[model samples]
Target: MDTPPRVPGLGTFLDKNTGTPKPPTPQLVTVASRLLLLAAVVQVVASVIAVVYAASPARLDAIQLQIDAMTGSTPSLAMMRNLGILTVVISGIATITAYVLFALFLAKGRSWARVAAGVLALLTVMQLLGITLPEGLTTVAQIVLGAVAVGLCYLPGPNHFFATVKAARS
Candidate 1:
Protein backbone atom coordinates (compact mmCIF):
# COMPACT_ATOMS: atom_id res chain seq x y z
CA MET A 1 0.00 0.00 0.00
CA ASP A 2 1.05 3.59 -0.64
CA THR A 3 2.01 6.11 2.04
CA PRO A 4 -0.59 8.34 3.68
CA PRO A 5 0.36 11.61 1.97
CA ARG A 6 -0.40 10.89 -1.67
CA VAL A 7 -1.70 13.32 -4.22
CA PRO A 8 -4.48 12.03 -6.47
CA GLY A 9 -3.46 13.01 -10.01
CA LEU A 10 0.17 12.07 -10.08
CA GLY A 11 1.97 9.16 -11.75
CA THR A 12 -0.44 6.50 -10.57
CA PHE A 13 -3.75 7.72 -11.96
CA LEU A 14 -2.62 9.86 -14.85
CA ASP A 15 -0.47 8.43 -17.63
CA LYS A 16 0.25 5.25 -15.74
CA ASN A 17 2.89 3.35 -17.61
CA THR A 18 1.74 -0.17 -17.21
CA GLY A 19 3.47 -2.37 -19.76
CA THR A 20 0.02 -3.12 -21.07
CA PRO A 21 -1.57 -0.62 -23.45
CA LYS A 22 -4.65 1.12 -22.11
CA PRO A 23 -7.88 0.48 -23.87
CA PRO A 24 -8.47 3.26 -26.36
CA THR A 25 -10.31 6.19 -24.77
CA PRO A 26 -13.95 6.30 -25.81
CA GLN A 27 -15.09 8.80 -28.43
CA LEU A 28 -17.32 10.50 -25.94
CA VAL A 29 -14.48 11.08 -23.50
CA THR A 30 -12.34 12.40 -26.29
CA VAL A 31 -15.05 14.82 -27.36
CA ALA A 32 -15.67 15.87 -23.80
CA SER A 33 -12.03 16.59 -23.18
CA ARG A 34 -11.71 18.59 -26.37
CA LEU A 35 -14.85 20.54 -25.67
CA LEU A 36 -13.63 21.37 -22.20
CA LEU A 37 -10.35 22.58 -23.66
CA LEU A 38 -12.25 24.73 -26.13
CA ALA A 39 -14.29 26.18 -23.35
CA ALA A 40 -11.13 27.06 -21.48
CA VAL A 41 -9.88 28.88 -24.54
CA VAL A 42 -13.11 30.80 -24.83
CA GLN A 43 -12.95 31.63 -21.16
CA VAL A 44 -9.46 33.00 -21.65
CA VAL A 45 -10.68 35.31 -24.40
CA ALA A 46 -13.64 36.40 -22.33
CA SER A 47 -11.42 37.14 -19.38
CA VAL A 48 -9.19 39.33 -21.51
CA ILE A 49 -12.22 41.11 -22.87
CA ALA A 50 -13.53 41.58 -19.36
CA VAL A 51 -10.23 42.98 -18.19
CA VAL A 52 -10.35 45.59 -20.96
CA TYR A 53 -13.99 46.40 -20.37
CA ALA A 54 -13.49 46.61 -16.65
CA ALA A 55 -10.73 49.14 -17.27
CA SER A 56 -13.00 51.47 -19.19
CA PRO A 57 -13.69 54.88 -17.58
CA ALA A 58 -17.43 54.29 -17.51
CA ARG A 59 -16.97 50.88 -15.94
CA LEU A 60 -14.64 52.19 -13.24
CA ASP A 61 -16.98 55.08 -12.49
CA ALA A 62 -19.88 52.68 -12.24
CA ILE A 63 -17.96 50.51 -9.81
CA GLN A 64 -17.02 53.54 -7.71
CA LEU A 65 -20.57 54.84 -7.73
CA GLN A 66 -21.98 51.46 -6.76
CA ILE A 67 -19.50 51.10 -3.89
CA ASP A 68 -20.19 54.65 -2.72
CA ALA A 69 -23.93 53.99 -2.75
CA MET A 70 -23.50 50.75 -0.78
CA THR A 71 -20.97 51.94 1.80
CA GLY A 72 -21.18 55.76 1.52
CA SER A 73 -17.47 55.82 0.71
CA THR A 74 -15.46 55.19 -2.46
CA PRO A 75 -11.88 54.19 -3.02
CA SER A 76 -9.61 56.00 -5.45
CA LEU A 77 -10.09 55.26 -9.17
CA ALA A 78 -6.68 53.58 -9.39
CA MET A 79 -7.41 51.25 -6.48
CA MET A 80 -10.89 50.35 -7.65
CA ARG A 81 -9.69 49.86 -11.20
CA ASN A 82 -6.92 47.55 -10.09
CA LEU A 83 -9.25 45.58 -7.89
CA GLY A 84 -11.87 45.23 -10.58
CA ILE A 85 -9.35 44.02 -13.10
CA LEU A 86 -7.69 41.78 -10.56
CA THR A 87 -10.97 40.24 -9.54
CA VAL A 88 -11.93 39.12 -13.03
CA VAL A 89 -8.38 38.20 -14.02
CA ILE A 90 -7.79 36.13 -10.94
CA SER A 91 -11.14 34.39 -11.27
CA GLY A 92 -10.48 33.67 -14.92
CA ILE A 93 -7.04 32.29 -14.21
CA ALA A 94 -8.32 29.95 -11.56
CA THR A 95 -11.15 28.72 -13.76
CA ILE A 96 -8.94 28.32 -16.81
CA THR A 97 -6.46 26.37 -14.72
CA ALA A 98 -9.20 24.10 -13.48
CA TYR A 99 -10.55 23.55 -16.96
CA VAL A 100 -7.15 22.63 -18.33
CA LEU A 101 -6.42 20.23 -15.50
CA PHE A 102 -9.88 18.70 -15.70
CA ALA A 103 -9.64 18.32 -19.46
CA LEU A 104 -6.26 16.64 -19.29
CA PHE A 105 -7.36 14.24 -16.59
CA LEU A 106 -10.68 13.69 -18.28
CA ALA A 107 -8.84 12.60 -21.41
CA LYS A 108 -6.98 10.17 -19.20
CA GLY A 109 -10.32 8.75 -18.11
CA ARG A 110 -10.37 10.19 -14.62
CA SER A 111 -13.89 9.84 -13.24
CA TRP A 112 -13.35 12.60 -10.71
CA ALA A 113 -12.66 15.01 -13.54
CA ARG A 114 -16.08 14.31 -14.93
CA VAL A 115 -17.72 15.07 -11.63
CA ALA A 116 -15.64 18.20 -11.10
CA ALA A 117 -16.32 19.35 -14.61
CA GLY A 118 -20.00 18.82 -14.06
CA VAL A 119 -19.90 20.94 -10.95
CA LEU A 120 -18.00 23.67 -12.76
CA ALA A 121 -20.50 23.55 -15.58
CA LEU A 122 -23.41 23.75 -13.19
CA LEU A 123 -21.92 26.74 -11.42
CA THR A 124 -21.23 28.47 -14.71
CA VAL A 125 -24.81 28.02 -15.80
CA MET A 126 -26.07 29.24 -12.48
CA GLN A 127 -24.22 32.54 -12.99
CA LEU A 128 -25.86 33.06 -16.37
CA LEU A 129 -28.39 35.45 -14.90
CA GLY A 130 -25.73 37.99 -13.91
CA ILE A 131 -23.62 37.88 -17.05
CA THR A 132 -23.31 41.04 -19.19
CA LEU A 133 -23.01 41.39 -22.94
CA PRO A 134 -20.05 40.75 -25.35
CA GLU A 135 -18.07 38.65 -22.91
CA GLY A 136 -21.32 37.34 -21.52
CA LEU A 137 -22.06 35.70 -24.83
CA THR A 138 -18.76 33.86 -24.71
CA THR A 139 -19.40 32.92 -21.12
CA VAL A 140 -22.73 31.47 -22.18
CA ALA A 141 -21.04 29.53 -24.94
CA GLN A 142 -18.40 28.27 -22.53
CA ILE A 143 -21.10 27.12 -20.14
CA VAL A 144 -22.98 25.28 -22.86
CA LEU A 145 -19.81 23.70 -24.18
CA GLY A 146 -18.69 22.74 -20.69
CA ALA A 147 -22.09 21.27 -19.86
CA VAL A 148 -22.08 19.15 -22.98
CA ALA A 149 -18.51 18.09 -22.33
CA VAL A 150 -19.21 17.02 -18.79
CA GLY A 151 -22.38 15.32 -19.95
CA LEU A 152 -20.45 13.29 -22.51
CA CYS A 153 -18.18 11.94 -19.83
CA TYR A 154 -21.23 10.44 -18.16
CA LEU A 155 -22.50 8.56 -21.17
CA PRO A 156 -22.39 4.75 -21.28
CA GLY A 157 -19.17 4.52 -23.25
CA PRO A 158 -17.24 6.94 -21.11
CA ASN A 159 -18.77 5.48 -17.98
CA HIS A 160 -17.32 2.12 -18.87
CA PHE A 161 -14.05 3.69 -19.89
CA PHE A 162 -13.69 5.49 -16.56
CA ALA A 163 -14.49 2.29 -14.72
CA THR A 164 -11.82 0.47 -16.62
CA VAL A 165 -9.42 3.28 -15.88
CA LYS A 166 -10.22 3.00 -12.23
CA ALA A 167 -9.51 -0.71 -12.33
CA ALA A 168 -6.22 -0.22 -14.06
CA ARG A 169 -5.20 2.47 -11.63
CA SER A 170 -5.70 0.15 -8.73
Candidate 2:
Protein backbone atom coordinates (compact mmCIF):
# COMPACT_ATOMS: atom_id res chain seq x y z
CA MET A 1 0.00 0.00 0.00
CA ASP A 2 1.23 3.48 -0.83
CA THR A 3 1.62 5.80 2.17
CA PRO A 4 -0.15 9.13 1.97
CA PRO A 5 1.94 12.28 2.15
CA ARG A 6 1.91 14.15 5.46
CA VAL A 7 -0.08 17.34 5.67
CA PRO A 8 2.05 20.40 6.31
CA GLY A 9 2.09 21.61 9.92
CA LEU A 10 -0.66 19.13 10.93
CA GLY A 11 1.74 16.26 11.78
CA THR A 12 -0.81 13.72 10.66
CA PHE A 13 -1.10 12.21 7.23
CA LEU A 14 -4.34 11.86 5.31
CA ASP A 15 -5.78 8.34 5.18
CA LYS A 16 -5.91 7.46 1.50
CA ASN A 17 -8.89 5.13 2.03
CA THR A 18 -11.05 7.50 4.14
CA GLY A 19 -9.49 10.73 2.96
CA THR A 20 -9.39 11.91 6.60
CA PRO A 21 -6.53 12.83 8.85
CA LYS A 22 -6.20 10.75 12.01
CA PRO A 23 -4.95 12.89 14.79
CA PRO A 24 -2.62 11.50 17.44
CA THR A 25 -3.34 11.47 21.16
CA PRO A 26 -3.13 14.96 22.53
CA GLN A 27 -0.73 15.79 25.40
CA LEU A 28 -3.70 16.84 27.50
CA VAL A 29 -5.04 13.29 27.38
CA THR A 30 -1.79 12.01 28.83
CA VAL A 31 -1.96 14.53 31.67
CA ALA A 32 -5.57 13.71 32.38
CA SER A 33 -4.83 9.99 32.48
CA ARG A 34 -2.15 10.55 35.08
CA LEU A 35 -4.48 12.73 37.14
CA LEU A 36 -7.15 10.06 37.04
CA LEU A 37 -4.72 7.50 38.39
CA LEU A 38 -3.70 9.87 41.16
CA ALA A 39 -7.32 10.40 42.04
CA ALA A 40 -7.78 6.64 42.28
CA VAL A 41 -4.91 6.43 44.73
CA VAL A 42 -6.43 9.19 46.83
CA GLN A 43 -9.75 7.38 46.88
CA VAL A 44 -8.09 4.14 47.94
CA VAL A 45 -6.40 5.85 50.84
CA ALA A 46 -9.69 7.42 51.91
CA SER A 47 -11.34 4.01 51.78
CA VAL A 48 -8.65 2.56 54.00
CA ILE A 49 -9.09 5.36 56.49
CA ALA A 50 -12.82 4.74 56.55
CA VAL A 51 -12.25 1.07 57.25
CA VAL A 52 -9.87 1.87 60.06
CA TYR A 53 -12.26 4.31 61.65
CA ALA A 54 -15.11 1.87 61.39
CA ALA A 55 -13.09 -0.79 63.16
CA SER A 56 -12.00 1.55 65.92
CA PRO A 57 -13.47 1.68 69.44
CA ALA A 58 -15.11 5.03 68.75
CA ARG A 59 -17.14 3.54 65.96
CA LEU A 60 -18.21 0.65 68.16
CA ASP A 61 -19.46 3.09 70.77
CA ALA A 62 -21.42 5.02 68.13
CA ILE A 63 -23.06 1.81 66.96
CA GLN A 64 -23.84 0.81 70.52
CA LEU A 65 -25.49 4.14 71.17
CA GLN A 66 -27.68 3.76 68.10
CA ILE A 67 -28.74 0.28 69.03
CA ASP A 68 -29.55 1.37 72.55
CA ALA A 69 -31.56 4.35 71.36
CA MET A 70 -33.45 2.30 68.80
CA THR A 71 -34.16 -0.76 70.91
CA GLY A 72 -33.98 0.56 74.47
CA SER A 73 -31.36 -2.11 75.06
CA THR A 74 -27.59 -2.12 74.80
CA PRO A 75 -25.92 -4.75 72.68
CA SER A 76 -22.75 -6.51 73.75
CA LEU A 77 -19.58 -4.64 72.87
CA ALA A 78 -18.24 -7.66 71.03
CA MET A 79 -21.34 -7.87 68.82
CA MET A 80 -21.18 -4.20 67.90
CA ARG A 81 -17.47 -4.43 67.18
CA ASN A 82 -17.90 -7.47 65.01
CA LEU A 83 -20.74 -5.90 63.01
CA GLY A 84 -18.94 -2.62 62.49
CA ILE A 85 -15.75 -4.33 61.38
CA LEU A 86 -17.60 -6.59 58.98
CA THR A 87 -19.62 -3.76 57.46
CA VAL A 88 -16.67 -1.47 57.05
CA VAL A 89 -14.36 -4.08 55.58
CA ILE A 90 -16.87 -5.25 53.00
CA SER A 91 -18.09 -1.82 51.91
CA GLY A 92 -14.67 -0.24 51.90
CA ILE A 93 -13.15 -2.95 49.74
CA ALA A 94 -16.03 -2.80 47.29
CA THR A 95 -15.85 0.96 46.99
CA ILE A 96 -12.09 0.92 46.47
CA THR A 97 -12.37 -1.80 43.87
CA ALA A 98 -14.96 0.12 41.92
CA TYR A 99 -12.92 3.31 42.01
CA VAL A 100 -9.81 1.52 40.80
CA LEU A 101 -11.72 -0.03 37.91
CA PHE A 102 -13.14 3.33 36.95
CA ALA A 103 -9.70 4.89 37.06
CA LEU A 104 -8.26 2.20 34.86
CA PHE A 105 -11.03 2.65 32.32
CA LEU A 106 -10.65 6.44 32.39
CA ALA A 107 -6.92 6.12 31.78
CA LYS A 108 -7.70 3.87 28.84
CA GLY A 109 -9.86 6.62 27.29
CA ARG A 110 -13.26 5.11 27.96
CA SER A 111 -16.15 7.58 27.96
CA TRP A 112 -18.23 5.51 30.35
CA ALA A 113 -15.50 5.61 32.97
CA ARG A 114 -15.54 9.39 32.92
CA VAL A 115 -19.31 9.36 33.33
CA ALA A 116 -19.16 6.91 36.21
CA ALA A 117 -16.44 8.88 37.96
CA GLY A 118 -18.38 12.10 37.54
CA VAL A 119 -21.50 10.54 39.01
CA LEU A 120 -19.66 9.07 41.96
CA ALA A 121 -17.90 12.35 42.68
CA LEU A 122 -21.13 14.29 42.52
CA LEU A 123 -22.80 11.90 44.89
CA THR A 124 -19.92 12.07 47.32
CA VAL A 125 -19.95 15.86 47.31
CA MET A 126 -23.66 15.93 47.79
CA GLN A 127 -23.45 13.54 50.69
CA LEU A 128 -20.76 15.59 52.32
CA LEU A 129 -22.79 18.73 51.91
CA GLY A 130 -25.69 17.07 53.67
CA ILE A 131 -23.56 16.92 56.80
CA THR A 132 -23.95 19.86 59.19
CA LEU A 133 -20.24 20.63 58.99
CA PRO A 134 -16.96 19.21 57.85
CA GLU A 135 -16.47 16.08 59.89
CA GLY A 136 -12.67 16.20 59.87
CA LEU A 137 -9.62 17.12 57.85
CA THR A 138 -9.58 13.77 56.16
CA THR A 139 -13.22 14.03 55.12
CA VAL A 140 -12.65 17.51 53.75
CA ALA A 141 -9.60 16.39 51.84
CA GLN A 142 -11.40 13.42 50.36
CA ILE A 143 -14.23 15.65 49.17
CA VAL A 144 -11.79 18.08 47.61
CA LEU A 145 -9.86 15.33 45.85
CA GLY A 146 -13.05 13.78 44.53
CA ALA A 147 -14.23 17.13 43.22
CA VAL A 148 -10.89 17.79 41.57
CA ALA A 149 -10.87 14.43 39.89
CA VAL A 150 -14.34 14.99 38.51
CA GLY A 151 -13.35 18.42 37.26
CA LEU A 152 -10.26 17.01 35.56
CA CYS A 153 -12.38 14.48 33.75
CA TYR A 154 -14.52 17.29 32.36
CA LEU A 155 -11.61 19.49 31.34
CA PRO A 156 -11.01 20.08 27.64
CA GLY A 157 -8.18 17.61 27.28
CA PRO A 158 -9.91 14.65 28.88
CA ASN A 159 -13.24 15.58 27.37
CA HIS A 160 -11.73 15.64 23.93
CA PHE A 161 -9.97 12.34 24.55
CA PHE A 162 -13.22 10.62 25.47
CA ALA A 163 -15.06 12.15 22.53
CA THR A 164 -12.35 11.26 20.06
CA VAL A 165 -12.18 7.70 21.29
CA LYS A 166 -15.92 7.30 21.07
CA ALA A 167 -16.02 8.73 17.58
CA ALA A 168 -13.26 6.44 16.40
CA ARG A 169 -15.01 3.41 17.85
CA SER A 170 -18.24 4.27 16.13
Candidate 3:
Protein backbone atom coordinates (compact mmCIF):
# COMPACT_ATOMS: atom_id res chain seq x y z
CA MET A 1 0.00 0.00 0.00
CA ASP A 2 1.31 3.42 -0.93
CA THR A 3 0.94 6.52 1.27
CA PRO A 4 0.28 10.03 -0.07
CA PRO A 5 3.15 12.44 -0.60
CA ARG A 6 3.83 14.91 2.22
CA VAL A 7 4.84 18.55 2.23
CA PRO A 8 7.85 19.42 4.39
CA GLY A 9 7.05 20.41 8.00
CA LEU A 10 3.31 19.71 7.68
CA GLY A 11 1.32 16.76 8.94
CA THR A 12 -1.07 17.06 6.00
CA PHE A 13 -0.74 14.80 3.01
CA LEU A 14 -1.71 15.41 -0.58
CA ASP A 15 -5.21 14.50 -1.65
CA LYS A 16 -5.06 10.74 -2.39
CA ASN A 17 -7.09 10.98 -5.56
CA THR A 18 -5.81 14.31 -6.99
CA GLY A 19 -2.15 14.29 -5.81
CA THR A 20 -2.46 18.09 -5.24
CA PRO A 21 -3.36 20.57 -2.51
CA LYS A 22 -6.47 20.48 -0.39
CA PRO A 23 -9.91 21.75 -1.43
CA PRO A 24 -10.98 25.34 -1.81
CA THR A 25 -11.33 27.68 1.17
CA PRO A 26 -14.41 27.17 3.32
CA GLN A 27 -17.43 29.49 3.58
CA LEU A 28 -16.57 30.60 7.12
CA VAL A 29 -13.25 32.07 6.02
CA THR A 30 -15.02 33.83 3.18
CA VAL A 31 -17.46 35.40 5.61
CA ALA A 32 -14.57 36.40 7.83
CA SER A 33 -12.98 38.15 4.87
CA ARG A 34 -16.15 40.08 4.12
CA LEU A 35 -16.65 41.06 7.73
CA LEU A 36 -13.05 42.22 7.98
CA LEU A 37 -13.47 44.31 4.83
CA LEU A 38 -16.59 45.90 6.29
CA ALA A 39 -14.72 46.68 9.48
CA ALA A 40 -11.98 48.29 7.41
CA VAL A 41 -14.55 50.56 5.80
CA VAL A 42 -15.92 51.59 9.18
CA GLN A 43 -12.40 52.30 10.38
CA VAL A 44 -11.88 54.60 7.41
CA VAL A 45 -15.08 56.45 8.26
CA ALA A 46 -14.06 56.77 11.89
CA SER A 47 -10.66 58.13 10.88
CA VAL A 48 -12.29 60.81 8.78
CA ILE A 49 -14.52 61.73 11.69
CA ALA A 50 -11.51 61.96 13.95
CA VAL A 51 -9.77 64.30 11.54
CA VAL A 52 -12.82 66.54 11.32
CA TYR A 53 -13.68 66.68 15.00
CA ALA A 54 -10.16 66.52 16.41
CA ALA A 55 -9.29 69.63 14.42
CA SER A 56 -12.22 71.72 15.71
CA PRO A 57 -11.37 74.70 17.97
CA ALA A 58 -13.85 73.66 20.66
CA ARG A 59 -12.47 70.15 20.65
CA LEU A 60 -8.93 71.51 20.92
CA ASP A 61 -9.98 73.71 23.83
CA ALA A 62 -11.59 70.76 25.57
CA ILE A 63 -8.42 68.75 25.07
CA GLN A 64 -6.35 71.68 26.36
CA LEU A 65 -8.48 71.89 29.49
CA GLN A 66 -7.85 68.23 30.14
CA ILE A 67 -4.15 68.64 29.53
CA ASP A 68 -4.01 71.68 31.85
CA ALA A 69 -5.80 69.78 34.60
CA MET A 70 -3.43 66.88 34.32
CA THR A 71 -0.05 68.57 33.68
CA GLY A 72 -0.70 72.19 34.80
CA SER A 73 0.92 73.45 31.62
CA THR A 74 -0.78 74.47 28.40
CA PRO A 75 0.76 74.14 24.95
CA SER A 76 -0.11 76.39 22.01
CA LEU A 77 -3.36 75.49 20.26
CA ALA A 78 -1.59 75.14 16.89
CA MET A 79 0.95 72.74 18.31
CA MET A 80 -1.71 70.64 19.96
CA ARG A 81 -3.78 70.53 16.77
CA ASN A 82 -0.77 69.50 14.71
CA LEU A 83 0.05 66.72 17.16
CA GLY A 84 -3.53 65.48 17.00
CA ILE A 85 -3.43 65.41 13.20
CA LEU A 86 -0.13 63.53 13.18
CA THR A 87 -1.42 60.97 15.64
CA VAL A 88 -4.60 60.38 13.70
CA VAL A 89 -2.89 60.01 10.34
CA ILE A 90 -0.25 57.60 11.62
CA SER A 91 -2.69 55.46 13.60
CA GLY A 92 -5.31 55.40 10.87
CA ILE A 93 -2.77 54.24 8.33
CA ALA A 94 -1.49 51.48 10.59
CA THR A 95 -4.97 50.26 11.56
CA ILE A 96 -6.31 50.19 8.02
CA THR A 97 -3.16 48.47 6.76
CA ALA A 98 -3.45 45.71 9.34
CA TYR A 99 -7.16 45.19 8.75
CA VAL A 100 -7.04 45.03 4.96
CA LEU A 101 -3.72 43.22 4.61
CA PHE A 102 -4.43 40.62 7.26
CA ALA A 103 -7.94 40.08 5.90
CA LEU A 104 -6.54 39.37 2.47
CA PHE A 105 -4.04 36.89 3.82
CA LEU A 106 -6.71 35.28 5.97
CA ALA A 107 -8.87 34.83 2.90
CA LYS A 108 -5.94 33.11 1.24
CA GLY A 109 -5.90 30.61 4.12
CA ARG A 110 -2.63 31.68 5.69
CA SER A 111 -2.23 30.10 9.11
CA TRP A 112 -0.14 32.95 10.46
CA ALA A 113 -2.77 35.41 9.30
CA ARG A 114 -5.26 33.82 11.69
CA VAL A 115 -3.05 34.53 14.68
CA ALA A 116 -2.07 37.94 13.35
CA ALA A 117 -5.72 38.90 12.90
CA GLY A 118 -6.53 38.08 16.51
CA VAL A 119 -3.75 40.41 17.62
CA LEU A 120 -4.98 43.06 15.19
CA ALA A 121 -8.53 42.86 16.52
CA LEU A 122 -7.34 43.54 20.05
CA LEU A 123 -5.06 46.37 18.98
CA THR A 124 -7.87 47.86 16.88
CA VAL A 125 -10.05 48.41 19.99
CA MET A 126 -7.33 50.55 21.55
CA GLN A 127 -7.28 52.73 18.45
CA LEU A 128 -11.08 52.90 18.31
CA LEU A 129 -11.13 54.43 21.78
CA GLY A 130 -9.38 57.50 20.39
CA ILE A 131 -12.19 58.21 17.94
CA THR A 132 -14.06 61.47 18.55
CA LEU A 133 -17.72 61.73 19.61
CA PRO A 134 -20.43 60.83 17.08
CA GLU A 135 -17.70 58.69 15.53
CA GLY A 136 -18.60 56.37 18.36
CA LEU A 137 -21.23 54.80 16.12
CA THR A 138 -18.65 53.66 13.59
CA THR A 139 -16.27 52.61 16.33
CA VAL A 140 -18.91 50.35 17.81
CA ALA A 141 -19.62 48.87 14.43
CA GLN A 142 -15.94 48.08 13.99
CA ILE A 143 -15.80 46.43 17.39
CA VAL A 144 -18.70 44.15 16.61
CA LEU A 145 -17.63 43.42 13.06
CA GLY A 146 -13.99 42.88 13.96
CA ALA A 147 -14.89 40.64 16.87
CA VAL A 148 -17.11 38.44 14.75
CA ALA A 149 -14.64 38.38 11.90
CA VAL A 150 -11.73 37.13 13.98
CA GLY A 151 -13.97 34.75 15.88
CA LEU A 152 -15.14 33.04 12.71
CA CYS A 153 -11.63 32.06 11.67
CA TYR A 154 -11.23 29.96 14.77
CA LEU A 155 -14.29 27.88 13.97
CA PRO A 156 -13.81 24.21 13.10
CA GLY A 157 -14.35 24.63 9.39
CA PRO A 158 -11.91 27.48 9.04
CA ASN A 159 -9.40 25.62 11.16
CA HIS A 160 -9.51 22.78 8.73
CA PHE A 161 -9.26 25.18 5.85
CA PHE A 162 -6.22 26.85 7.31
CA ALA A 163 -4.61 23.55 8.19
CA THR A 164 -5.09 22.20 4.70
CA VAL A 165 -3.58 25.31 3.23
CA LYS A 166 -0.70 25.13 5.65
CA ALA A 167 0.02 21.50 4.96
CA ALA A 168 -0.29 22.05 1.27
CA ARG A 169 1.94 25.08 1.21
CA SER A 170 4.47 23.95 3.74
Best by lDDT: 1
Per-residue CA lDDT of model 2 for 35-143, tens digit only, reads 5556556666666766677777787878878777775566787877777677767765665666677766666567676677767666666545445342344445555
TM-scores, each model vs. reference: 0.85, 0.65, 0.77
Better of 2 and 3 by lDDT: 3
Query: For model 3, how does the per-residue alpha-carbon lDDT over 60-110 read when each residue is reduced to its tens digit?
Result: 888778777775566776787888988998888888888898788888887
- In Å, residue 105's CA in model 3 sits off its true spot by 0.4
Please rank every candidate by lDDT, starting with the best. 1, 3, 2
- Error of model 3, residue 36, in angstroms: 0.8
Off by over 4 Å in 3: 1-22, 63-74, 127-133
Model 1, residue 114: distance off in Å is 0.3
Model 1 shows how many backbone clashes? Answer: 0
Distance from true location, Cα of 96 in model 3, Å:
0.4
Which pairs clash in the backbone of model 2? none
lDDT values of the candidates? 0.85, 0.63, 0.79
What local lDDT score does residue 54 receive in model 3, on the 0 to 100 scale? 81
lDDT of 2 at 10: 35
Candidate 2 weakest lDDT stretch, 10 residues: 9-18
Q: Encode model 1's per-residue lDDT on 89-157: one tens digit a residue.
A: 999999999999999989887888899999998888876887777668987898899989988887888
